[model samples]
Target: MLGLHKKWCLGICVVVYGQLLINALLTTNKTWNELDWLDILGEGGTALLILLWLYFILAARPGGRVTNLMGAGLLAFFVGVFQDALDEIFHMGASTPWHSVVESVASPLGMILMTVGLYFWRQEQGVVNRQLKKREKLFRQHQLVDTVTQITELNYFKYHLRIALSAKHVKRKFTLLLLDINQFNRVNQRFGNAEGDRILHAISELIMLNLRDDDLLSRYAGDRYAILLANTIEAEANVIGQELIAAIEHFAFKTLQGERVRLAASVGLACAREDSVDSILMRAKQALALAKQQTNSSALGQLVAV
Candidate 1:
């Protein structure tokens, strides 16, 4: 991603500098006396603003529809203001009509494109906000989040689970679910590690979307996730596991080459007992193994009691 933004920055620099050079060469007879500080301030400021927009758009988002449209709009605005700023410093004479046309048309057209881009961006943000609402109550430390999956790591998850388990006189049953992506190594081998990470991230989002607001989801390790279902029994946990498995199976994740890959999840469920966290986790891991062995015939792994 850094490489992608670096290329964009280089392209912007080249275009802006190249436009200035061309303007300088064309204004062969111009004197420094023609320079207007006010015009330079206005047009140059606009150019700077357009560059800022481009930087924010590229830096904050992945390449997608909103980014593409916003990038194009900013590029158009940059080109427009770049020309206007040059025209103020140079006497283009007979070529001034073309310059006026470009300056007049490009900025407005760029604004219209930017408006459309902003509308789509708002829609995208709404979806993000809803997802955040679901996960925010479970945990709220932004710094401890995993970069690749954008969820909490295993340690934080364990910390919370231990707290929930120790609470006295809670009527609701607490269950732990551990899910491993079946044949996930094949995805990395076939589509490369980057695509495989994308798939894992997508799967993590899918799991969050399917879970209740009270549930805590985290990346346990490579190709595995740990979920804490507060106030859920084994029967209810099994149902949630099936839903997650179905969601992943139905998800048509595509590779960079536009090839769709189907996915399967093997889940293990274990209810909390009067034992240490390590013991409960071991039970879930053992159940997960059983679930993986049964993945061919069952949609979800077997539920094991402690």
Candidate 2:
């Protein structure tokens, strides 16, 4: 079946071949009991879903240049996910070759492809829904991506938020998670804005990795990011939010001068209600404020103990 899609399949097959060769040269297999089965399930499940989507994309679409381009983009995502699931079975230590290379490159490459696809998809939808009105002026493609963080800008996020809200079903629910980086300005003052910008980019990438692909991530403003999660209730959003926070916490970012930086994030959760964008944003802002306050208190207590 894949043989029919030549170009699309070629790129993915090459990546798989290289990955296999690298693993053969560098990695050792973990014992059955030592493997993290749960993590494998999560990562493998994601890969399976991407593969299924790829299959549907090929099966449903007619042969065309656009279809092949989309297929190639989807293949990048599949490779990234496939690599992640493979990591669970192999005990690749800190010295693993191409460990950082493939993930750092492929995932973002796929993300950019998917994001561009979303923009074109939105433009196509705009023709069908002229009611969007003045909102079209805000979406100038390149302008919708943040300069520093490279995620979608606040305006772009609002655009997607409108779409998500409008497409809402009576039975289906979507939730929003707002996250603020703790003591971000202090990091800037201490390590210069260059380092701070790098941290923002890293945090943004980390948040993206934790996302379910369907989720929307945008830089709400400085040191703050917003995520729109589909089919999520408050409880599920809370779990996902915590996972993001944990991912940020565990990320070991280093400065130019060899200083290790510890990062923490506070999340505010809000679910869609009455389909009002402003209303949901306000709730998320309030929750974020409260979370920041609690984070501040915890820091204060730790300082006092010291």
Top-TM-score structure, candidate number: 1
The TM-score values for the models, in the order shown, are 0.56, 0.53
Candidate 2 positional error at 225, Å:
0.2
**Model 1 deviation from the true structure expressed as Cα RMSD, one decimal place:** 8.7
Cα lDDT of model 1 by residue, 1-306, tens digit: 545666667877888888778777766545778778898899888799879878878988887888778887888878888888877778876765777787888888888888899999999987886777545445478876787898888888888877887888568688999989888898899899999999989989989989998888889999999999989988889889888878888899988899999788888888987857898899999988887777757644343333
* Model 2 lDDT tens row, 1-306: 555676655665687688767776688888888988899999989987887887787776666555665676777877777787788887776887577677667777877776676566567557744433222233457667789987788888888788878873777788988888888899999999999999999888888878874677889999999888878887778778888878888889999888999888888888887857898898888888888778887752110000
Clashing pairs in 2: none
Candidate 1 local accuracy as lDDT?
0.82
- Would you list the C-alpha lDDT of every candidate in the order shown? 0.82, 0.77
What residue pairs are clashing in model 1? none
